[model samples]
Target: MAVPDPRGGPAPAARAGRPRIAIVGPTHPYKGGIAQHTTELAHRLARRGHDVWIESWSAQYPARLYPGQQRVDAPEMEPFPATGYPLSWWRPDGWVRLGRRLRRRADAVVVVVVTPIQAPAYLGILAGLGRAGRRAAGPAVLALCHNVLPHERRRLDEPLIRAVLRRAGAVLVHTDAEATRAAALTAAPVRVAAMAPHLWTAPSRRVHAADAPAAPDRAGEPAGQATGEATSALGGPRRRLLFFGLVRPYKGLDVLLRALAAGPPDVALTVAGEFWGGQEATQALVAELGLADRVELRPGYVDAADVPALFAAADALVLPYRAGTASQNVDLAHLHGLPVVATSVGTLPAAVSDGVDGLLVPPGDPAALAAALRRLYEPGVLTALAAKVRPPDTAGGWERYLDTLLEAIEGQRRVDHR
Candidate 1:
């Protein structure tokens, strides 16, 4: 059955006469920063009464090809009904059909672009929309870029990303560093939209209870647990360091483990989130270093709903990435009022004000990471850093983002008029 357009033509009652936009991307149940941003973007735009429609994935990833456990977790809330349009990653036919459906349904399209893996699919969709008549009120594509390209230092990824990015009406990046990298991709107008703050929007002091451990106490140690650091008069958990998110080779987990080996033995580290390729190697390294117990590894895809608990349980968010642009994890840390400790690679410094919000060390330097970790574990360091963190201003703050997107769309509209 062909999915009928949910909104039958532009209704007279749409507030301010703004166009109803359709958001297309991976949504809820998917465990990752990209999925979180897509869901939140839809929620924020929808609250604006602009008639937002989320066209989520019919099948996000094939099982054999997927590195993680699943494409998405079991849906917590009601699932968005299928538009009766299903697309295969390998086949452009389905994307062509879906693109036509989207052009008819929405005045604008916000496509959240992740990896180059999905480039062909997105490009096919764009081609279909382009053919739907340039002057027609077809959906305008706004590419919300999480990363300009893959982080594994692939030269081809740049061109691959640029090709699809150029096809879009507008591109949205998360940080200044990313803007620079993306600028090299295409002259297409790019908007620097900060990633949404926090793991989940509503901030709460109450410890998020999940399968993960609860928030730690003033002793710099986890609550409801013993054997970690104990508070001395002033409430503080034992110094806990976290390297959250997926474990991939480029993420520099091995460097972090080596740093842990070099750092104070008492300073415990938590390596949460699932492993993609280097699990055995990382685990073997941990045992080789005799720091097996010092490092806690929770290797599995963490559901978005469960992120709060994992974040709250730690004292700081650490990113030892070898290469990459700004991380959504840093934004989430700031939103949760947690400080960060990261290497000087990509736009980490852009998100963190060293000695202010968190600390920054040289990328791939274990000694520097060790020193940084020691400083963070020192008394009052975590609390002081946490105090410096202010929740990111995301709500109603997409002016730059909206302006750039409008310019591209309107420019294209004019070209079509000619």
Candidate 2:
């Protein structure tokens, strides 16, 4: 026999071992990477016979918390089916109410931690889950941290995120480094699960053409056709690099600009993403570095339709992070058949196979990135890397990710029983 969903419709528990799971996070009509990841995870979990409820937000945050544009006109990916919008940022009581409801209904609760600002809401949820009461038992709480802290940290970030982690039964992070950060925050067991492939990897998504071969090794060749950039001062073939996604200070667009300036003057760059701030500063730097003509800046949110043109035009995608974490850009680049040139920060070093898929340099080092740029334009380097570029094992990856998540929840339950 099945059970009743706390909200409505039929629920899980028709089986013996499967648990009723609730994942608290942003889902449609929210947009962005986190939303996509949350939605996909729920769908997959349900497919595996678990009753999964996406306890999404009625109001995720105030404008001050995330200044960037939020929703898309359409769902960024497939909208999750069983989502409930019971919690809002302004309403503290609702958080507790939802927690109490989950405490009664769910066997496990996965708290998706995207930013530190939502810490209070999570704390409220924990309180209602009976963590503060004698009932101190409810759903097994698992904090799934995309990042332990924000990429750009604030003074209160650590303490705030720490509070939520301390309350959880277990914490799950995408990288070992993030696992270490979670361990420091709470006595809760930390488990490292490779970031699941939440990206759209179907054949239909591969609308962009593979990159053309790099220009000849010699200088003074009008190799503009090889890439979509203008010829260099030496009239060498210009290599166009892409800097995709939302532009943030921590992501190192400035360092990449300096790298572009230091590198072969024939190299050109296309920065296609919404900027969080510093657009004027970026423009001034481009002008100061004499990259005004060579750098094409499309300063707004990129629509899905326009993505193909951006990838089609670039020889490779670039990730120059001063600080970092797991990102979908490497896989995004590979999906479009473009290799990546990234700093060996966060999961980039692992995703990007140096000398095989793309090049990697030290974080924040403009000189090293420039050298990698130079080497990329070498006769066969770019083409060779592009040839070796392959889509990530998204199917197997998700299965493994789910296994890791379940094990952590089970392991924590065993620990609690002891």
Candidate 3:
């Protein structure tokens, strides 16, 4: 027998002993890592035997809040089967209605908290669920924080984030540092679960063997398969050291640029992805550094189909984050068989394995980053690091993350009842 979808679409058949889950966040038509993460989470949960649905947003943010392009011409991942866009920034009534609907439909709710701007809408949802709704009577709420707070803080960030987290029965953070931050704001249980691999490609996308002759990038550029500036035994720099993803202030692309100028002269860089702000400043920096000839800037949303080539054409992925919680970038690079050179902040040290898989430098320190870049170009260093690069254990990581999430839901519900 087919269970009726609350929104009038066909729902999965109700199964014995399986929970019905509602994941509230961005999805396809929405771009970037968070959107992909949310969609993949729903798919993984359903694959693991739960009945899942994505309660997505028709209008995620007001133009004033997120000025950049939000939707994409093409999707980067497999879209979830059951999704509804009943929530919108302009509709407070929809928020409350969706909340009450979720109470009737889902066994639990996972609200993907990407920013504090989402707090007001989330509060409205919880309000419709009766503010302090009892878990026995309604679905338990878990605030799955991609960032407990944005790396760049705002004036109302604390109070807004506090409102949502405290109201939530449990909070899930991606790192211990984020848990510490979340604990300061909420009395609810805060659990640390590392992000799973969503951007992971098929096994075929793995880097060709080190000894394999220089492979041509899908775009037809030779992979060079080389390391840095100087012509080594293998030849000269084929891939520019890469700085991919959103260019936000906290991400430290400026620091990376300064490092690039000071590091090996022959080493070039390709900076890709949309800039949250500061495109002019970045352009000016490139001009100021005299790196015009050495840098290639492609500032826009990169499609999912183009990701492998970005990784393919890079000697290493450079993540010079001044601060962070966790990111799928390091794992994404490893899956492509590309090593990383990143800052030692947040969960990066744990993920990058300094001197093993990737090099770690101090956050916000241009000199340190420059030195790491220079070191990366040293003869044979890049190859040695690349050899250690391994694909993230996608299944194991998701299973562990799911286990933590489910346990948090149960544990928080028990606490709420008490």
Candidate 4:
């Protein structure tokens, strides 16, 4: 059963008849937040009696262009279909045709915007859809922005960013910080919504047995002492630390390994997921730090089916990303009620309440990360953190998020009419 979102409430009626919605983004074989968000949003909207369709990519990225494996997660779930819509960089007309078909069918279009790397594909699809349906007056395009700017810093990104934002009728950002940046990017207004609750695998609400053997105490409390509430797998006696997802330089896995090496010898680290450019460098660094024994490297792209076992085995999740706009890893950790240890980069601090839900350290600071690890390593810390950590509110109550979009649409409609 899907868990109820903590922040979910009643939503206002969505037009008279059920509204038709088209969600366009990287889905299925492609993993990560972009894919997950697209899937969850479709699922949510479908449940609400909306005629929903997902225009996922047929060809997302070439092997050379990808940092890790071909796809992020395995195609275990039915949602992970082999192919649906093919994206050809050379054939913009073919893509535009497909987009027009979707636009004709959909009452509204929700485009999931990512980095510049995907700008060409998304921008083309949006254009196609807009041209497809002659909407004298209807729902405008809604761009759900994960990041207003690009990572790795590119001179070309600003122009592309400006173009996409200017093209959209309205925009939705998960955080206020992103909203502020989006405001500056385009004349189209940006609205802020709480991060979607089911961005990753849904949370498990099954309460753990109190006084269960080896049950760890709450954070800021003693070991073997129950906090009266059920503890997550992380709060169990054997603490597991997960560095789940594809490995990237900005993700800072090397710093996490070094922190484990320099800190307590008892704490263990699981370096799961496929590696990118820095894998060799990271492996060498692990050996140099003498963490070969303490660190378990499960290299290669991990399948989504395996995530439960991987996360269940761990005590806490570590996201030492040196630079990031926002991440679903932190949200995934919260879904399991597993405490997180992340650096103060982008919107990380907003998700993790230092000393309340999880610890926050400076990005790229191994020492501070080591210290945070030690804090979590202390038995029962994660249980306490879990009690206080609130999962994001995204469910039947998506209207709150939609309100932000509607406000922009209404405002823009006024302007367009004027």
Summed over model 1, clashes come to: 13
Error of 2 at 140 (Å): 0.8
Candidate 2: lDDT of 380?
A: 74
- Indicate whether candidate 2 or candidate 4 has the larger TM-score: 2
Local accuracy of candidate 4 as per-residue lDDT tens digits, 65-162: 77565564343233622124556545667566656665555556777887776777666766776622323233467788887785566898888877
Angstrom error of the Cα, residue 39, model 4: value is: 1.3
Candidate 4: clashing pairs of residues? 58-85, 217-380, 218-380, 218-384, 219-381, 219-384, 234-315, 240-314, 240-315, 274-300
The TM-scores, one per candidate, come to 0.81, 0.89, 0.89, 0.78
lDDT of 1 at 148: 79
Whole-model Cα lDDT per candidate? 0.66, 0.80, 0.79, 0.65
Instruction: Give the number of colliding residue pairs in candidate 4.
Output: 10
What's the true lDDT of residue 415 in model 1?
54
Clashing pairs in 2: 232-266
lDDT, candidate 1, equals: 0.66
Q: Which stretches of candidate 4 lie over 4 Å from their true place?
A: 1-19, 72-86, 129-139, 199-239, 379-383, 386-399, 406-418
Error of 4 at 20 (Å): 2.9
**Model 1 spans > 4 angstroms off:** 1-17, 74-85, 131-138, 153-156, 201-238, 396-418
Off by over 4 Å in 3: 1-14, 132-137, 200-239, 415-418
lDDT of 3 by residue, 11-48 (tens): 45447755677888999888888988898888777777
Regarding TM-score, does 1 or 4 come out ahead?
A: 1
Across residues 132-168, which tens digit of lDDT does each residue of candidate 1 receive?
2333346567778888777774666767787787777
